[model samples]
Target: MLNLAKIGHFFLHLWRGVRELSGDDAYVQYLKHHAAFHANAVDVAPALSRKAFFKLWQDSQWKDVRRCC
Candidate 1:
């Protein structure tokens, strides 16, 4: 039973690492942050939908127009 639990944990950690490295986990973090800090705030707008959030994230990531020579 201990070995089985270890295997399950290993897979879970592997999956989380892959999601993090691939940028697939950003939305989940964003949601958690929003829920923790802004879900009840009076002035903040509601959280962005997943599609909008990704669009905004992508835009911000590439918006600086940096060039590497």
Candidate 2:
């Protein structure tokens, strides 16, 4: 099974990538053009669910999940 800490780390990386991509005009244009196609797309796990996930995450003894890499 994948560790929760690793999962959190992966999400952090994904968020960063999204932020960066959103800043690029080309990416923005692509998103605009493909808005309908990707409209239903959702993150594997969302940042909003972090709090709930973290509670379970902490219970897993992965408390250092937030430690800077």
Instruction: Point to the candidate with the largest lDDT.
Output: 1
lDDT of 1 by residue, 1-69 (tens): 469988999999999999988789999999999989987788998889999999998888877865788
> Could you tally the backbone clashes for each prediction?
0, 0
Across residues 1-69, which tens digit of lDDT does each residue of candidate 2 receive? 879999999999998788766542334443454565666777532232435544554466555564665
Candidate 1 backbone clash number: 0
Model 2 sits at a Cα RMSD from the real structure of 16.7
User: Over the full model, what C-alpha lDDT does candidate 1 score relative to the true structure?
Assistant: 0.91
What's the true lDDT of residue 1 in model 1?
43
Model 2 per-residue lDDT at 42: 79
